[model samples]
Target chain A: MSEIVDWVAVDWGTSNLRAWGIGPNGAVTFKKTSPKGMGKLAREEFPAALDELLDNVAPARSGPLDVLICGMAGARQGWLEAPYLEAPTDLRGLLDGAVRPTMPDPRIAPAILPGVCQKAGADNVMRGEETQLLGLAALTPGFSGVVCMPGTHSKWAQLSGTRIEQFSTAMTGEMFEVLRTHSVLRHSLTGDLDGPGRAEGFAAGAAAGLDHPEQLLGTLFQVRAGSLLSGRQPDWCAGYLSGLLVGTEIGSNRHLIGDQPVPLIGSPALSALYAQVLAMAGARGEPMDATAIVLAGLKAARSFAA
Target chain B: MSEIVDWVAVDWGTSNLRAWGIGPNGAVTFKKTSPKGMGKLAREEFPAALDELLDNVAPARSGPLDVLICGMAGARQGWLEAPYLEAPTDLRGLLDGAVRPTMPDPRIAPAILPGVCQKAGADNVMRGEETQLLGLAALTPGFSGVVCMPGTHSKWAQLSGTRIEQFSTAMTGEMFEVLRTHSVLRHSLTGDLDGPGRAEGFAAGAAAGLDHPEQLLGTLFQVRAGSLLSGRQPDWCAGYLSGLLVGTEIGSNRHLIGDQPVPLIGSPALSALYAQVLAMAGARGEPMDATAIVLAGLKAARSFAA
Candidate 1:
């Protein structure tokens, strides 16, 4: 087992396949990724892809290797279906089990665990982000704040003493796409602009939305008419639209999280964007290094198993 | 004045200018248009653009000209600033008056009137489309129904007797543009579809939204997660997304005009699209002839003035 030993942690997602190899000391020695995302691969193809990566990291005689996996790859559509855990769960209870790709050698991957969610009258489920959250909790002891992970559908997970209390997902980014590119507002703004801090228009939009969300559809028309009739700049209107979405999300979830500061996990650009908007709403937030958090989660799992 | 009359109506809008010369009996003698749409011209350039078009059709040397102008050119940003009229107004009362460039001969151009919207304490306003509604009313008497003019912003207006009783605008089309081009959702969708009719994924999206709006954001993450995990088809997801926006519009406005047949005033493609949706919701509808409606509004104004 020692001869075949190497770092093995999987970032298995629906469309992305990523795995890393680390030394015994928890240092990443090498990493590999492939197109064999969970969504594309057939059920039978799972073990082969894992082997393709493991084959590079451990090429010696056959021996057992410690492995860990996370993400949607542990989902129903993944190689080994992992059932969801309810919210307020510890690390082990949050997951079902990891999958071992059926290999000819019968030496397959370890089981992955799924994330948990809890909402009355709603079907709540999460997969990979939970590990990141666990990693986050490991890195920052006694962090009872909001962990916001931004994406196509951004999730705001509330944690209370290492247990995920509750969470909500907002479609602001997706709605932004719908409004900017596919909708009529495209004619008003030609391209995108980036400012270091939150855009003024975004702030205005959020404030307007917080004031009256019911008038959202009607107010958007004024963006075009305002430009056509009053020479309102299109770029500003774009920013305003962004504010509306971010503001709306905050308005919906603000009460749920209380006045706790938010810890953002994601890429730099996304975290910065969220921080800017949160600041405008008078909410406090800090950027947490996602890679560090993911590794911390892995180390915690290793320690748990040990 | 009667003998020289060729086209009696001129519709000047942003980006393009159109004029119709009529015979003595009001039959169309000639029709012409210029690239001088409101989009291309600055505020000061309006008079010159108007003069160029007049030089061709109603030259002073030819005869006395009776022309009516409408569209964005009459907006606050255009050459002649036409104040909007309040709702429940007749064509004559909505008239903002016409303008003739002082440079050319003393020619007369009738200004088109804007429609009005008064929402409680909100200010009232109107524009060129109201004229088209008026024209439509003249052509079809006792016209008491809703007119849906689809464009950047889709406007729905109720015409009672000869007055435009009430109106509302939806940013549905604009939202479509934003989502398709600007947001991360843009990445999830295939650039363009082969044809106009609903795609397969569209139905799924519609059902999803109509059945579960709360799950929208969470489900959208599947687009990215699915691609990451399972290599989900982007094209089908794109269609599904289109359905969500279209479905949301239908769902939100169901209360205002529930299952009622309304007249569609727009392009054939727009008409067909709306018809498909309305059909799904068990609502009846017919396409309003756009050219006829606009001209009818012009004729109605003439008759009302005479």
Candidate 2:
């Protein structure tokens, strides 16, 4: 496995690190993942963590393996700060800002991709998602529109062809999780964010959220009040809360989204949920395979690192 | 002191239990508090917790002390559900729906006041704040205006004279605390919420929030992005976050607020903060003492129990 491997395309995030071994023929030879994310590791430990994860994958590489990394691994607190490539730039511009971190293991050659930043109007930044957007542009040449990447900090990016003009981030996902687990609503909500979450509950909540996004403060309380006064179930309460946050996010940004079919690049369950919420607003959320897009992104970065 | 205490006015909440011993003259004779709030105590433990707090205040008593309890003690998961008194009702009517818990100690005559609920258009509920609103009504005779109570869960009520026609709860305070401590913004913010949290930061953030509260999901992320791009200080980030949330809460409900002075019933610091944010949106927030108000509410509640 080590002898055949040419390079590794890595997506290193705050809490997880995933990698794909690329063969000399430009096809994936192996796939691997590790819990050694950037969040828990110190600057000095990144090289070792990468080496350990790689050692498990291929221990006998004839030459140093080139590693092209994206995401939080390039954060200020990551292995080494990869300065942001200001937005309204082409995905191809990412390679110019790509930084190479000194590695302790001679068998590993590391290059961490720079994140995208929008410094002017609404102070905003993105780390790993920029690469995914780059991948989207690479897979679909001249792709232009809004791309929604949902996660702890869901991002909404505007791209003109292969160039990103502007982007914004919504803390909706994090808010939903915190309120569900830490606020008074926690008492009314039970169950995890796994599976479909709660379709009926989400639809009802999404309706409320979409109707009056400005009335979010009051509507949030409705989640708790619904359970207390109306005997709403735990799952329904959870779904309602989820829908409310998502609806608020989409509703707030819909003006910029227009009526175009937005590309949702994330997990199947989450993308499907976003797609459903999009239809409620008369738009379509086109799902893109996250792995395929990210891999394509890493592959694109390979050209710069190689 | 127990001999002089004719009754006890108690405000029991999720994390704290506070009692005011009332003398025969209808004045607070002594004050005492305990960590045995409804959130930590069980149904059977409420009686003992009340006894311990009362014992610390006044050990020797001649007869059974009439105890009037309000807040979470009457919640569904409380010592006993006092059942929410559906809204469009007067403060005096709260006494009519009060329920007495079966206490083992005959020395303590406990009556838990019911909360208020709005089941129509926007489902909303309030515990403890109802009594404070009652206090406001009692303190300001012929009061007919909106009251903003800031705390863990801030409540905004439309009061016509002594009756609460409608009310809504905003998870602003809880949301602020959670995002500051648990979310990505936590990494950017440092320092306790004590003292006047950065004034300059608040003024700026409040303006942004007031301008476009619909962008709350995005404005929240700026707390981190500001620190990252603009090198914002920790205290500034904290105040900015605080201001953004407070502004959003007030801004979202501004249409109903008009340009009138809202009577703010809560802690001095919190009330001042809300007052500042309200002023930003051209509305005045008149600060009222929380203790005097709640005690007044409980004192008024005493008449019904007696």
Candidate 3:
């Protein structure tokens, strides 16, 4: 028959909404995803969206159901503002900063976890990734080193045991998107990073970004110029743009890695790309499955709840 | 009686069309601009757009009007492909590479000037800016040193007398536009460069970019983090972004400038911004009027044509 839902774990980002139903044994019993992300929903619409997702799998309980969420859903403009928790924070206590939203359904108790913010030297923040970090800590007990989460906003964190000592964010994915779609470089890019010359282009771009990061502004224009002058194919241009941004991100944050192999947490494809670039930069990357980490993180966070 | 038009100088770019009526005495008799740019018009629509703009001001000439055009109008997909004049070439002969398009109205003899292209090292291209370089050469009479043209794609050219030895293009302005509009950093930006804390923010960003050009990808996220953590104002974030991009561009291209006073060419406001950054970098920026340079460049180009 149906497995009883112990709690629900949600990763609500700007462009997507994902929910996982956990069994009492801490195993994920059900998982669902929707395009109705935090970006798409208004404050009031959030409850209905969550309800729709949970309707089929939520266990019929007499009291309130525990729904734990991370990501943009906790941002200032999301369902309810969960002010950021400053960095140098212990991952074990991430759920302590979780704020509960006033819900119309008394049966649903939604607790949104606050993102981690870096206030010193370089200002930075991460919402959903903190959960993943917690999961990482659980998966590898007493883990200490740098963690790279590659995506639209790639985050690099320095962990001291179970505590995140510092972190930085790079708008690498967003920059690639905007340059690919909105800028003049659009004419030169084919949008297929796997096409011919892509690997070579990516390698070249990454090297350039790593060696001379200051030349990024100048380097970006080469995509269009290479097309016009050297007949550089569109796919290669796309690959080069990706490589350049990724390389720059890795190159700039090398200090955080400190000669240690970086733990890359993301989708396989994205993590592989980062791994490739990381290798080129004279470093190694340890890839980890993002979903597993998030589930583990959610389970850990749920254990601390009231 | 309407003033007779000897020839017309047109700067047709991706976003706007500007034309100046030049009399036989080489003086601008009339000037007008339109939203009908090269990007907006199809190949067949170009003649009509030109005719509409030329109407009521063609001087009722019996023969075809001589139209000297520069910019994207000479692009491969423009009215007709004008091809490109490979650089390390003299600016005086820019008209020699001009191509005449087939027109419905024989009354319109449009000779589109070719842009400059660099095939070596990092591939680079410039369309309308070649005219400005030509104009700069004409206005200064054997002007040398590096010339900086700030725009959507900022161009930096090393000119020895009338010949452009080498040049580079930076996607600074385009980067700023995309980051400001499409990225998450948008929330932190006010779209105002003159707001409180703007000057300090700009100076700080420029210094950071100059100091650690490699840190650009990491540096950009500070806008959002600063806003979330320190309540950084939107305007200050905008200024910081602008400064960071500009400083990165300047720092990377320092080799092109070589301790020479750089000539800044563009609208006063934009040139002034570049000037401020240049001053910060210990380089003097000599601002020149873009209109005068374009007119001069066009006149020089016309002098070479039959």
lDDT of each: 0.65, 0.85, 0.85
Q: Rank the candidates by DockQ, best first.
A: 3, 2, 1
TM for candidate 1 is 0.64
lDDT of 1 by residue, A75-190 (tens): 66568777656676776454334445445555544557665655442335577788888888888888887788876567888886567877766777767766666565666666
Which stretches of model 1 miss by more than 4 angstroms? A1-130, A136-153, A156-216, A223-243, A247-298, A301-306, B1-7, B43-63, B86-92, B97-105, B108-112, B115-127, B195-198, B208-238
Off by over 4 Å in 2: A1-6, A52-64, A191-197, A302-306, B1-6, B23-25, B52-64, B105-107, B191-197, B302-306
Candidate 3 segments exceeding 4 Å error: A32-35, A53-64, A105-107, A190-194, A302-306, B23-25, B52-65, B104-108, B190-197, B304-306
Q: What ranking of all candidate models by TM-score puts the best one first?
A: 2, 3, 1
The candidate with the higher lDDT, 1 or 3, is 3
lDDT of 2 by residue, B153-215 (tens): 899999987789998888888888888878889988876533354787888888888888888
What is residue B141's positional error in candidate 2, in angstroms? Answer: 2.2
By TM-score, the best candidate is: 2
Error of 2 at B92 (Å): 1.5
